[model samples]
Target: MKQSTDKIAVLIISAIKGGGAERSVLTLGQGFHELGYKVHILRFKSLTEYDLNPNLAYHLLKFKPYKLIPNERFRHKLFARAIDNFIEKKIGKPDIILSNLEPSDRVMVHSKLPNIMYIIRNNISNKFRLTDNNKLENKISKLQNIYRKHPCVCVSKGVENDLQARLGPHITSTTIYNPFDKQLIKQMSNELYSTPHSVLKPNQYIVHVGSFTYQKAHDVLLKAYAQSSKAYPLVLLGKGKMFDETKALAKSLGIDDKVIFLGFNKNPYPYMKHSRGLVLSSRFEGFVRVIPEALTLDTPVISTDCPSGPSEMLPASSLVPVDDIDALAIKMKELMAEPQSFRVSLDESFLPKNIAQQYIDYLTS
Candidate 1:
């Protein structure tokens, strides 16, 4: 489809109010506005705290149609229907509707509008997993038949492969890694770096910034941190059901004293900047966005070589085998002993200005 020349209105939808996917949408909205396009955000619920460029305009839809579904079995079907109505009514047929999360994404693509292009940006790895239960074939068909035949941009190559393998190469998806604002990253880094080490307190602390969820493998992270003989603090930043379970696990490991659950803090950069190194123990990722942010902040990183992201994000020498407590611990140890050399080779592709250009191309072309 040829790129439309108009005001270029874009409507984005997401499930939750925060996290990497939410932040990515907000950053892109700001970038879109900077490119002189009109942008609007339609969220299912409400945001606790979020940052968006003040100039950008948005609309919020607050409804629990997903909750009204008789049960979880056909909940996705009902949720998609609800979003369809919202797009038809409030959205008023934008140039494009961008769905960034599950259920909502399925709905937007299923609308089958010819004038309005539906762009579904895959936010999780499980959505594209090839399996009978996943219903990938049916979903792909629905997308192609319904939406105005726009591209499906998976955030990571692993996600792209899973889609291609299950749905076949004919569906061809693009892998667009998330972009970061290099200037903002450098600004944040400089601001954090200038703070006195005495005030920031260079305590023996390792930071993990992500929701307390299964994909994050926080259980394994806490366990690995517990096994560390080196006496250092392990700080977790995020709120979820797993928070309590993780606390109990720490207590059971007899290392609860070493773990500090900071809950969710708006500004984690200061803590991340002053920490020994950032640790990520995810089962899989499109690309772990936080790892790059940590590197930008000059924080050394110790991550599990999880499917798709870590091996690509970090050098072969920097990654530990996924779910291997011993390997994770060893890398953590190595980083703590010699941090500067490890961070010198950080990747620059994620910088915001570079990423903004990619979005501009997507929107314009």
Candidate 2:
């Protein structure tokens, strides 16, 4: 594959937080850079939690304060205009622009930018239900308009289906799974921890890596773990506003001793590599990156058959219904009793190079 030395691709997102969407943007940016496309990242905020490729150019936009405006729609429009002006001044126009999340996508759509690709990162139906304000009807109307104006890319087929259902079938879109860096994850997993933590004892615990939030359904995970008869402990990795509440839930269930909370480890691959298995109890997902990451490491995985991602990635046997404590417990116990029986095959279609090339082809087309 010959490198495109003259092409430039700009990736726009809210921030470089340690979430699946943010990580996907970073991976795509790195892939484009490796392919000799001059890549740039335009983020809304300056706070970065993940490491970025040094070759990629980074730019931050400072949004104007609109606290006086009570209507979020107006505020968003104002901020979108500000972002348009910022891009014009700082980076000018690129060969292509890949924007992530609703805010960035809305901005790009409103900007009337050519060769813009909007990446939808979650189950839109579930996310709107969780975060939508009183103007629900109006919100959907605006989203439908945005979808009609741009070429959208969803992280999974489930997400794509949900989006078309919500915005009408005429909305132009395609599915592009999130890319994974297998070599990087494997290398990180092999690196010795500077300070070894006792909670990471080999084959002694099942691991769940995600934010402790309502969407992640940590409460359901705790309840399932309590119901299961498995002897291995459960480890929760990552931090969120619901940390204390989730801890209290574990205590209330009388399984605090068996549950360990290791808040936000930057290198969770080492822990994932040594764990008995990885479990995802998300209420919904765009595409569960951890499932593939675990499979790449040969770790077994069990996930809730949520709205968007799990059913697409895992076999029916490895999935249980969302928030179904009894079924989740049964699956957990089954995996624990015969861990080797539930290994998932990693899909090579999501390799970084392949997905990146798809993006290039789409943008150029």
Candidate 3:
């Protein structure tokens, strides 16, 4: 068996934060460190605030150190090229390069480096909108051709299937589920996972933990919560630019008081563990890790049976038709009315350490 000391540096690039892919990369980097590997994470731009383990070595490929100054058209291109070239030179020939953030095209430039593997970790599914679907299908098709010359990995089997279906067999891809620290999640849950909104001195409430974006379908979630016959407060956590529209929708539906927007907070485990049950109304997903997260906390879940994940992760009894606010409302009411019977545990077969070993085996093979 090859010890972790034999492992070379695994580099993960981040354009910015506040995305599942970014969060997964950070979590994986921490896992690598825990496994006694020499791990290094490189970011295109310096992070303003990142929650990361202090032991890992993080590199920010910034042109200017003092402040983040956005470069102009040509200058931005040159800056990007410079960063790519700098990564190739200073990284001392990495064993693998994990691309998690946007503009995945940057990997094409670094593909020049010899003896280094490429792992493409994607989190979102390609079924949201027509415009995005068109763009992604095209780009992913091109990436498929590129991967024929050099292979890479995908985040989930759903994403792998979508890639192969769109780009054809020329793309070589395999699914590696996101790795979350089970011990850490347990500890975090134990410390912070209090009854939903215990801080607010309340016990009956519905919780949603995700960015306030359209893909999350907060509008439908709120509409469903409003329509639900159960009389309980709804807590919407996480921050985003779309808050005003979602808030406005709640007011229009005349349930503004019933819905509470808690903005963004790093520690949402407490809110999640304490809530009556989690309500996720995503349009699509590569795989919803939060489904398992909620289950690990023994929190009941009521999710829209979306394309690739929620239904597959949770029991069929917990799922409802996508965009069907009536069904969603009914499901939420069912869980709320029967909290004792609703609580359930997530399957442990796909735990983080096991998933990490799967990736390692595939990469080494």
Candidate 4:
């Protein structure tokens, strides 16, 4: 499976929508492009919002999945053909194909494409525990079938272990921690942020950067914030279905005025830079990027010791128990009182070029 430097690598994803997974795809595209691969992002849906790279290419090929077909295999095969045909016409045959998210995996596993692999960005087993408790084994059997078709690359070791612990040794996959351009993140964090309302002052507010989703456990954060010392305002950055609901929760907690909801800024690094510290209270996570992102800006950070990610990079002092409001509140008070930031001691293997090479090597080997 070895290839020349000028090879084509098509990244299949749901959309270029914002989130950690989407950001990872775009950043990896740059990594592939930099390595002299003709990198292209082929999204089934056209929900674009993130900053695009000039060196990379993107194609939106929307096709209706044949769900009405009686046979599951036949319909998925038909869908995969549409994806293959889209690549055949839009670009030359790709040297390798990497699919991300559940949307792509739903059909791309049936794809007869070349050297295809799936990138797992979530705690799949934990998600099953939350969503499919009644028929967990059957759901895992379905996933086992998917892995049999194309191997996977998990974003964290905990994610890999969780899958293997359930799916067993028969699965084909490896862990590759998410890559970050630290200097770029630091540079962007230096940019001054202007707001329409009262401005955000440096070291005067506590910040949390995550979409208002159940997975983010915003309710826990709100409860904990209300119990904290309230030395600084709590700034919530990001927007989703849970936005209004989270706002309502803040009001219910009687901390509405003390909580700031700044919905979905393209760049949240400045807020991370200026905040006293960052907090992530996710119920589960793949790789908590903000934990490291805040560390990159030298901002003190704390997170729930969720299923994955946090403990991998964060020291014990920076972690609180998942879904524990009291524990989080105590730590929140600690952060407000102290200005200490952790040293960014991430692995050099997490660099873009190194990570890109690892992907290539994984496919070739």
Candidate 5:
């Protein structure tokens, strides 16, 4: 499939939440825009946590009446219909549609739009395991059937393999790693903060940036940090439902004084740049964006060898067994002892422009 001059691409996701999936969608939109395509982001709501590209257009599916309906199934059906109508009337038909997240994917699949590409940004099986609701399970089962009928993009080889194992090989899918804008990260990291965070002392603290959640396994990180002999404070960035619980865990581990909970900072790049090292303790991830982002800043990283991403992004020596407090503690100690020795350049394959081209090829193909 050759590129068309008048191509129009529409990227759909539930909302602009501060997560890897949202960031990936934003990066892809920018990529498509750079390729001379008219990019439009179709979101279900107007709520956003991350910044959007100025070049890309934005469309919203305004269906507030769906909330009035008491029945869940019928509400979803109406929501899907509303999306289809909005796309037809407001945006018309796009040359290509890229859908992210389950809610948006469900609507896209239900719309039965042509040239629809569903992006699997996480380990679906692990996500499903995170919940036990029968209704949600049924919804996911339906989404899986819809996913089978469309071309899909997985963020990593491990994610691609996991999807195939669950949905079978009949599904057409391709692996495209997430893009990292190294120059942009460096530029942002250099921006001076009006008020410097007191916790960010020079080479005195390691950083961990992610939502405070069970999947991130902050407990494991806290336990590991507690066991380690390093004196550097652990600075945690990002907020979530488990923020208080994680704080309590740190206190219980007797490392509260050494751990600084900064909540969420819009610009964590500066912190990443100044930190001695970054740590990711996810139990499973589709792809850990922080790994490459940290490496881009010339910061050493120690991560758990989770199901899909850490091993793929970091050297084997820098990865420890998942959820093994002792192993993570040992790795943390080694990293803190010689953080400079562990620093390595990220592979050029993850360059933003290169990965962006891969997306264009996949979408066009």
Candidate 6:
């Protein structure tokens, strides 16, 4: 058997964007670097928002499939080969390879790359939106084809179970929650930061930090916020395609003035640190990264009991049913009426070093 430090880990993703999964993937790369392995992040795009550690190797490919190739499977094979050639020439073969997100998963499905594991970041059933049952089944079949090849690592047990139910029992999978830089999160929580929009006042606002996506269910959040006792101003701290539409919905709900959109801030910790509480009203999530971030700051959080994460992270008291506006509104009011003495501790296993060990154990097993 090889020593742990002798193993090389390569993580492939689209890019280092401002999404939750990307954030945790970067932290996981850092964890591998800290464990004394030579780590590399091979990405298909050059986009980056977060500061990267200098110790880890990063290869920016900015890849696009050649549409000239008629067959999708054959095209993916060539794409995978291009990546494999670069890895062999520049960095040698990775001892273990892990793929993230859909684009990367596409090539990795046909990849002859060694010891590869596909990381399922969300609930498989909710992976797409389709009205036709046949279309949905076709999409599910595509995913089954990709994930069927390798041993999988899901971000939550809920995701693992979803995969089993959706894709059947042929594949092997396990749950490994994303790693958080707990110390960094705690330190950043104390930071004095500024946003282009209105300045955030400490202990005076309820914060909801997620992109304006269908999965995030911001409409539900806004509707529920309007019905709540209006105890605190709401701060939304991310941007998406539905941002303008969501803002319009806020006005339609007559709570536009009470809701603040600061777009996407790289450091949302300062806001989380001083907020009254953090709220997540999602339809589904791989796992809400902010729940751990808020808990690291000792701030309370309320989330919809969505698939793949909230239940694993928060207690029953802090959860509400998904898409239930009335229940969420009542919970919000209860949160405000009760004393703000909620103290919760996130598990130490969330720390990057420990989470990295879980990955190592899984890959080496």
Ranked by lDDT, top first: 6, 4, 2, 5, 3, 1
Instruction: Give the Cα RMSD of candidate 1.
Output: 4.8
Models, CA RMSD each:
4.8, 3.2, 4.4, 2.5, 3.1, 2.6
Pairs with backbone N, CA or C atoms under 3 Å apart (clashes), candidate 3: 195-274, 196-274, 196-275
Would you give me the overall lDDT of model 4? 0.84
lDDT of 2 by residue, 144-173 (tens): 888788788898999999999888888988
Question: In terms of TM-score, how similar is model 3 to the real structure?
Answer: 0.84
- TM-scores for the candidates: 0.81, 0.92, 0.84, 0.94, 0.92, 0.94
lDDT of each: 0.65, 0.84, 0.66, 0.84, 0.82, 0.85
Off-target runs (Cα >4 Å) in candidate 5 are: 1-5, 70-74, 130-140, 194-199
**Candidate 3 C-alpha lDDT tens digits along 1-365:** 23343354555565447566666766777666655666777776676344776756778765444225453334445655665576656555555556554354344433454434445544333432454655776666545555565555666666667666666776666777777666666677656433343434434787888888777899888888888864778888878878899999999999887888887766666777777878888877767667777777778887887766675667788888888888888888887787555566666645654665666677678
For candidate 5, list the clashing residue pairs, or say none.
none
State model 1's lDDT: 0.65
Model 6 residue runs over 4 Å out of place are 1-6, 65-68, 195-199, 339-342
TM-score head-to-head 2 vs 5, winner: 2
Q: Which residue runs does candidate 4 get wrong by more than 4 Å?
A: 1-5, 65-72, 130-134, 341-344
Local accuracy of candidate 5 as per-residue lDDT tens digits, 90-110: 666677788897777666666
Q: What is the lDDT of residue 217 in candidate 1?
A: 89
For model 2, what is the C-alpha lDDT against the true structure?
Answer: 0.84
Ranking by TM-score: 6, 4, 2, 5, 3, 1
lDDT, candidate 1, 312-362, per-residue tens:
667877788878988777777776676664673466666544554564566
lDDT tens per residue, model 6, 269-294: 99988888888999988878989888
The TM-score measured for candidate 4 stands at 0.94
Best by lDDT: 6
After superposing candidate 2, which stretches have Cα over 4 Å from the reference?
1-5, 64-82, 85-89, 130-134, 194-199
